[model samples]
Target: MKSFLYPNIHPPSFTWINAEKTQIEKVHEWIKPITNKSNPVECKTAEIIVLGVPLSRSSISVSGASEFPEAFRRSWRSFTTYNLEDDIDLSSMEILDAGDVPMHVTDIRKCHQNIIQASTALYNHFPASTICAIGGDHSITAMMVKGMHRAYPVKKIGILQFDTHFDLRDLSDNGPSNGTPMRNLIESGDVNGTDMYNIGLHGFFNSQDLKNYADEKGVHYFTLRQMRKAGVRETVHQCLEELSSKVDVIYLTVDMDVLDIAYAPGVPASTPGGMTTEELLEGVLEAGKHPSVMSMDIVCLDPLKDAHAQPTVKLGTHVFLTFLTGVMLRKV
Candidate 1:
């Protein structure tokens, strides 16, 4: 196998807190950081590989989303990896935090290329490994999806996008912004538009033009109101069942703005009404455990916009753990 060139760009280093012995039994204790270069075999042997992509230059509006990975890592230190509901402790799993991708400040194209290299490297390193990527912004999803398609060319890839916006706008004039990733993916043929399923699309937050374009392109979508009417769980089950039948593998991309502004005020495009945090968690866990789901990402958490209480940061970290728990419990 060709080894991936690890980017030389500088990003935040993973910092392990020196918590008191009494508080050592948290999720921080479970997450093992891959700070140094490891043997190729060692990298390939991990059950789960977590990587951070810290580029936010194409924010479309708000900036500082690049700081999300570090903020989420910091918040994760305060939680426990053990799931009380599932009665499972994830500390035993072989999980590796592969650190953030080296970001380019001036060249957005270079930053996106680095993301593709990182994703391809991580995915190709292991035959059975599932990846969980922390985002700089939703635009990175275009590169991640492209990377995955490159890594597994034979399989048909399905995308499950959890967000408040369709993100299918044309960016021909502005370059590649976060609002244009899905459109780019469809146009590039990395993933078919019909294979893309979007949930929690909020009213007023998305324009009629985007909705019409999505429908015209055959992108499967459901609004927050539609989801509420059908019940979130049932709505997800219905979508997942139909989606799974059409594609060989599923890649889940979560945009934090999917949640109500009250729940995720830190997101760049957050609005007044949206899905509840619990609804997103349940849907993510359900999808993570499915046989067809191979990789996932949570995007658009701008730490600068977070509340003094840091509720959005806390929720983002918790969602990562929740998805991991579901993956850990998957049947062989």
Candidate 2:
């Protein structure tokens, strides 16, 4: 049992939406919480489990990304369980909040180990549940996948990442930064590049070396331009088709920087040229509709950089809602 896991033991706070005397039940009100236990969790009730990893020491750039998971939980108050686009009531769905994996800010290695241990323990206990995570930074993903592989050694996992960068930077010189997770996973033989599909890559954010490395590894990538040209739904379906068919399960990771800087100012590395909010939502919804998608993590959020309106934070929460709505559709 890892001593680093902290379940949401505190009492719930009043939602911002409710302060307005609204009759609608917001997402935070609908979400169910489960305290972390050292023993294997009983898997009879949950359909999805949400884990928080507050880590950022390994980011390639300076950021307050460690504040993201908490920020996301708070942001949950702003959304309703209803999805107008899908005509699905998320109340029909089930989400088990697994609280957070306490991060060791000064020790990236230790923090990663906590993520791996917590992920492996929880996943093994609830093997049938879909795992979802709100991250401190992108680095936690490599560790999470490592745990996934450990929990189910026989399963071949596919990755579907929505990001601006390839995140394939070699860790030889710098060791396990946010920019090196994908490469680290591939190098470790935990995830195959051929089973990975990276979407929303654009701008001058990436390098030729990284592109060459990705190509050499056989990573399938589709740029924002390609999404626009091919249509978001079409491209996503094609990617999901290939991934779901070839791998036993799919892991979806969304780097908030994949959105345009104008819309996602809270993301540490967001740039001018990126996917529109709608494009990203639509893209992830496609992934959620597929039964093979076993896990997802929304990362790179830096709440300190957010505007007073808190658009970025709220948008990130909306991404989860839309995806869950897709899951609801499939369940019905």
Q: Say which candidate scores most in TM-score.
A: 1
Model 1 alpha-carbon drift over 4 Å, by segment: 1-5, 8-12, 17-24
Local distance difference test values of all predictions, in order? 0.82, 0.82
What lDDT is reached at residue 171 by model 1?
73
TM-scores for every candidate against the unseen true structure: 0.93, 0.91
Instruction: Please give me the total number of clashing residue pairs in predicted model 1.
Output: 0
61: Cα error in model 1, Å:
1.0
- The pairs that clash in candidate 2 are none
- List candidate 2 stretches off by more than 4 Å: 1-24, 36-43
lDDT of 1 by residue, 1-332 (tens): 11233452233356565545543367777666664454667767788877888878988886788998888888876788778998887877777777788877799998988888877777777658888889889999999888888888888988998998899998785567899989989989888899999989876877888889998999999988888898877877787788899999889899998998988889888888888888999988887777778889989999999989788989998888888888887853
